[model samples]
Target: MWRSKARQWLLRIPTPKCSPLQYQVPPGTLIASRMPSNRPLPTFTCLQNPRLLSASPSFNSRDLDDSDVGIVGNAVNADDSRESEASPVNLDGEMDESGSFGEKGQVLQEFGDSSLGFDDDKVMSEAADVDSLSSLWEESVSADDSSGVFGSQEASDGVVDEIHEVDDEQVESVLSLLQSTLVEPLEASLNKMELSLSEDFAVRVIETPSISGENLVGFFKWAWRNCRSVRTARVVELLVLAVSDVPELGKREGYMLWDLVKEIGAEKGIVKTEILNQLISMFWKMGKAKAGLEVFDKFADFGCVPNSDSYYYTIEALGKRSMFDTAWTVCEKMISSGRLPDREKIGRIIAFFCKGKKGKEAHSMYSAAKEKEICPQRSWLDSLVCSLTKNDETVSLAFELLDDYAKGSLKYANKSFADVVKGLCRIGDVKEAKKLVLRMVESGPPPGNAVFNFVITALSKGGEMEDAIALMKVMEGRGLRPDVYTYTVVMSGYAKGGMMDEACKIFSEARKRHSKLSPATYHVLTRGYCKMEEFEKATDCLKEMKKDGVQPNTDEYNKMIQSLCLKALDWRTAEQLLEETKESGVPLKGITRSLIAAVKELEVEIQSAENNIEA
Candidate 1:
């Protein structure tokens, strides 16, 4: 009856299925039968059939854990050797039909005695080992279940990296939504886009067409309230661009804006160099260049270091608007700070210095640049050389710099030689220029056609047409062909000398060589005819300009209308020209002013003649 009960338990249990790594046991089933080391194995003295001790069908390597097998291997039976061997169960909890009970008892006894040693110390050590292994297996299974629910660690990280990358199109779309002028709509658009902007980029995007000053200030306050980090430079720049056009951004407004920016900068501990430079750029763009200079002066009080770009832009802005004295002060400041302006900026500085008639100071700057191994641009060097040659005292020094430059860098020899010729001719010293030309020709490398054109232009302006015409012939004798600039210069010279026929001949020659002539070339001929009071020829010039697809600018139209007005032509013709000027989208202010003044003067003369006749 005991054998039947054990056999029935084994049959009732389900079979274990094989998996990739191990066999799986049924849920809620105890995979191993535990018998404590302190307790003895159960004795079945009445059970005679050894097959009843066979393992359940559900029992497999995975169903019985390693610890259960270890305990079974340590179990010893005290039955007779033949009877123990006849038992079917093996130490691995598997049924072994070939082993008799006697052999099983012998194997079990040997396993328990030799391997387990069955002492208290040995059992305790084995128990600790089993506990550690069990904990490790549980942890591994928990990790696998988590991974199955989600994904592998590497795959999840890749998805997160992709989500963080910024898209330019998305940024533009967000900016587009903020085009509404109303605060409520703007807030709604921002929420709809679900976007956040860095405060600097946000300020840049405030240039939407419908955004007003009030809207901007509200948005700024909102950003501040929300603790957004805005760049001081970008905020100042945006305010200057957007608000300066509305009304005078008065001292009170400027102070408020600056205080806000400064307070933020102080809180963040940011470097204020860039912010100050931006303020200067803003003032210059708004035509408040003197104010920009004052802003630069405040840099020291704010503990900001003004960089080379700061001084460079200030000087350039002042110089462009003819504020030379202030520009010089800023340049001096830059030099004192021991920071050299970059190559492009240095060109502007040298040009400004030359404009102030301080050729010596400009040359000194160029020398310093050279000493520092900063190569000046070809255009800047040419301008400096020309300016130096214009003055009697610096001409020799200019040549010395050029000679030194030529020795060090051989690439600019032709350009240097041409500029020198042009400068000497400009100053009405063609005799020295002629000598230089002869030397350039006799030498292995000849001067360009630009030098010959410069000489011809000088002679024609000085009333030496015969000499000018002779030089043009000699220029063609050389292998070099004249470019459009060469032709334009000669035409300008002839026109200025009242030699319209000669000027037209040069214009036709240029047209023959190159099918297209510049608008400047056409203007030269028109002005020459106008000066000669040949209205028909001048009118023909305008028609030709139109046929050539060259739209005359405001100045060109002014010249033509002035000629017509001075000739006392019909007001109807002037009216027609005014209409054309309007249709062409050129500004009508100057043209209309000239026409109105000319008509009023003609009316006054007509009334005076009528009064004389009546008397």
Candidate 2:
């Protein structure tokens, strides 16, 4: 009877709405439960003991008074509602409010507080403790976010700063150690430290302010001795730049670094062509052209063959320092290697030779280069021929070189031939220049009239009036009309040679042909009169210049003043001419200013003499 009564009581119990179980059940397992209404019991598969579920005694308890039970039931309902609102449970029950099983247990424990046998006061105290623990957890998380592995944000930054300070201190330590130890004898220091000088160590040496060049040299020597190698390019280039930044060491004195660098490089058996070339250029920029050449010469010893650029820089540096012989040797080497210097470098070398009046050597180098099938470029040849022609000793040879080259190489024949004529004319070899001009006409189309004008001018200047006129006739026959430059050249040439009549005739011809004389044409006539001390005639020419709407430029005025002071001995007229020049807004030439001073000095001397006589 008691069992039947218990069964009835159990049957009357409504199905409780509980939280989803955390554990999973096997497939095909059945669960049975009854509803509150008069409905049949529902069967659930894959669930065990659906009628009576096991609950943890620590979370749920059966010991409760009726009043406490009522309160606990309401509290459990409220807690369930709060959990449901906090995290929605999936209907399929595949996941719970807490996806993790451990978190789900904590959730269950918190909700299980309602089933505890404690009174309302004990439950309230536990709730307050739980809230305090949650707040502490959040604050700990916040602290972790700000501090990372360190204690606080500032402490984290302080850690990073400490790391940087450690690195800086390491650098300072290394530098200080090197400064003290490197001052000792190199062998003794090496023996004591047994140092391994790496690129960083070399960089430290280069950047250290207390490091002297001698100390640097010793360090590198020691490094090379121990390691059998050195940082030839990287360390050396940095050292060079550093030394160059120092004004005292930047000049030729800085080249001492090269000696050390070379020693190190040679010891290491490292001879790179590009590095050597750069070293040469570095020396040149530092005003050590000779040192650059020295580096160039040693390139072969290091097994690096000098390229055309290498040879060009060496020759240029040598030439710039007026070391012509060495420059010529380097050029010869360049040519022997079947290479030619670049045009700009060639011009520099040629100018160097011209300044020294060693034009024959320059021409010889050109000829040798051509013989070796390494002809200079046309622009370089033009500069060379121009330089050679300016020298009296090499003008004929320069023309011969052009004439010979013209026979085989017609590409530059016309231009080369023209250079020859112009060069010969510049050297007052109009006779040769005319012959070369005819040769050029035969070889190619007629040369420009400017070529004939150069020869005519040269002949007239040489007092060969007949040759000058003949060349002019030849120019006209070739359908080349003489321009203002031509007339000016011929007239100035005749005037310089004191043949005023021929100059006048050339002027008349210019007017007849062109129908107008340029300002330069008038200046030529004025200069001619000045050279002959014909002051009145020169003055008339100036007046005609103004009447013809051409002003006498500074050169024309300077020429007249110089003649009046030097030849005419008429300081008064020179003074008046200078005053007019100033009024005309022309800047006085240096020579003109000196002439005024001379006139003032002469006047002071005359005044002193008259005073002495009066006394």
Candidate with top lDDT is: 1
The lDDT of model 2 is 0.61
**Cα lDDT, model 1, residue 18:** 22
Per-residue accuracy of model 2 over 1-615 as CA lDDT, tens digit each: 322222222222232355534223221111111112222212222222331222211222223223221111112233234334443222222345454222221112222232333455554444432234334434454565424321354542343222211244444554565567445565575566545456566676667776555555555556656653345567666665555444445443356667766675654445467667767776666557778888887876777788877987787667667787777787778767876665556656666766666777777666655675654665555556666767677677766656444344565556656767787766666677788778767776368876777787777667777777777777788888878887787787778878889888888888788756788898888887887778989888888878867777887888888888888767888888888888889877887879867977887899999999999
**Model 2, total clashes:** 0
Steric clash pairs (candidate 2): none
lDDT of each: 0.62, 0.61
Q: What are the per-residue Cα lDDT tens digits for candidate 1 across 1-615?
A: 322222222222222222212322221122234334343232222222222232233333445433442222112234434333344455444445663222222122232333333454444344433234335434444556534422345543443322333456755775455444444655555556655545645565565545444445445544555534554455645654564443544554444455555555554434367776766765666566776787788777667788987887687657657887777777777777777788987887898798788788788778767877887776766778778877877776665655554444444567767767777776677887877776677752377777888887787678777877777776778776777877887788889989899889989899899878888999999898988888778878988888988888888877777777767555555666677888988775664667756786787899899999999
In order, what is each prediction's RMSD in angstroms?
21.2, 24.9
Model 1 — which ten-residue stretch has the worst lDDT?
Answer: 43-52
Q: Which regions of candidate 1 deviate over 4 angstroms?
A: 1-210, 221-271, 404-615
Residue 172, model 1, lDDT: 74
lDDT score, residue 79, model 2? Answer: 29
